[model samples]
Target: MGTTRTIKNKHAANGSGIKGSKASKNGPVNDGVIKAKKNAGTRAPIPGSGVKGRPNLADILKKRKKRVYSEKELGLPQLNMVTPVGVQKPRGKKKGKVFVDDRESMATILAIVQAEKDGQIESKMIKARQMEEIREARRAEADKKESERKAKLEETKDSLRKKRKRPRAGGKTQDDDVNGFEAVKALAAEGTKAAKPKKKRVSFAAD
Candidate 1:
């Protein structure tokens, strides 16, 4: 009789001897493995890779239509892009008429005068106001007289212009009067004829 030998199968084990489920959650993962995953598709073509001759993940993904690429990643020259800034237009200044109220100033002046104990100052202010009023009245009267004078002068000029434009009377001589008297004498000698009726004029177009 022959001795029976046991054989181990290599395909029976799915992974490394370490079980992922049984592994400690707080344990540190391999830095090289983590780094390899992060830098899988982002590696530049300048330096040599530690691995054998193999295409990068980026190179494989670039063939796919859904992948977006940058200039640096595609090994193209970088473009200088300028961002547009919004500019506000300057507004025009309003040219408005500014009206000043003298009520406050007058009130302040009144208050100052009242605060002073001198009666002479008050009387002087009153006299100044009365003088101003009289001056204004005189100015108004002068303006009115000047306006009336201008109106009268204009009327006189208009009358002179109308006279210049008026037609002169006819210059009848003695010979013209003699001729007129002879014509009247001839008409008186002749018998009066029947007046002819005037013909009617057509006022509208025929339909």
Candidate 2:
């Protein structure tokens, strides 16, 4: 039992020793040491040369200055420059001159004139229609008056014909009096003749 306890204590001390130690504090593992050896062989730095600073290309371009140009050389007007050529004098009369020259401008003027003409034509047509209406109204009134006058004349003519057909007492005809006073006179004569008794009575007066 004493030998067995000594063996068990030695085994527990070995397991704890490995568990408590840090991996990075100890030397590198076999795989990591092999990778470091391969990279050092292929990527070795040059002797006496460290990392270089970036180039200052902007300072090198600033040393070369751009060329300047004069106003006369560039065909531009200068402040002190004078007019060497004299001004041209005017010529001929200004009468009968046409200001607008292009076809487009002349077409615009013609359009305005045409519009005015069309407006005038429309106005004239409207006036003509109005005048026609007035004439028609007058003709209607004249026709109405003519009809009225004709009716009055016909009425007067009909009255005159009726008066002529009727017989007047002052201008009576023989036929009209035959049935009036003439008939009465004939009856009175017949009565008087019948009343006289043969007139022989006159001879008896001698007896």
Candidate 3:
């Protein structure tokens, strides 16, 4: 019994000591932790490191390059600078005036202002007599054409009614006058009498 107890203790000790022996020989160190600390320090200064203040409008405008244009530039009006697409500029007021661009619109407005300064009336009116004459002419033309068309339609209907009422060849007519059985019998008798020869009247002469 004492020898068996000693053998079981030796087996348990051998099993537990193997893992601790291997770990002592090749365990990992703290190099990975040190490297991670160094990386965190380098990344801390990267944020908010560039362009720290508000932008100056004057400085930006001064730094922008200026575009050169000659006196006779293509597709541009002589007086006004050309705006980019989708930018709408204000125009001046004038009667019967249209604008191709800002310059032309401004010119038209100035002309209207000058005219108003000279105390000219800007509104125009149509003559009442001319308007009445035009209205009367249109009414007369419409009435004449309408009457002519109605007459033509009525004539066409009348001709159609006449054609419908007319009798065809070898067909019965309303004027033929044979309507009932009595009229038919009378006609038959008259036809027979006319077809027969008439007898001459015999006269006895006294000597």
List candidate 2 segments past 4 Å from native.
1-96, 168-207
Q: What is the descending TM-score order?
A: 2, 1, 3
lDDT of candidate 2 over 140-162, digit per residue (tens): 99999999999999998887655
Tens digits of per-residue lDDT for model 1 on 1-207? 011100011111112112321352422242223223333434532222334233453243233212222212454323445535544233484555655468998788778777784677788999999999999999999999999999999999887555332311221243235456543433333324323211110110010
> Could you give candidate 3's per-residue lDDT for residues 1-207 as a string of tens digits?
444333433343333334333543322222222223223544522331223232342232112211112212333454347777656554554645654678878899889899886654333224566778899999999999999999999999887555433422222344244344443443455457754311210110000
Q: Estimate each model's TM-score.
A: 0.26, 0.35, 0.23
- Give the least accurate 10-residue stretch of model 3, judged by summed lDDT: 198-207
Model 3 alpha-carbon drift over 4 Å, by segment? 1-126, 168-207
Backbone clashes under 3 angstroms, per model: 0, 0, 0
Model 3 clash pairs are: none
Candidate 2: what lDDT? 0.46
Shift of residue 20 alpha carbon in model 3, Å: 99
**Candidates' C-alpha lDDT:** 0.40, 0.46, 0.42
Q: Give the clash total for candidate 1.
A: 0
| lDDT score at residue 91, model 2, on the 0-100 scale | 47
| Residue 188, model 1, lDDT | 38
- Evaluate residue 158 in candidate 2 and report its C-alpha lDDT on the 0 to 100 scale: 81
Order by lDDT, highest first: 2, 3, 1
Report the number of the highest-TM-score candidate.
Answer: 2
Candidate 3's error at 103, in angstroms? 42
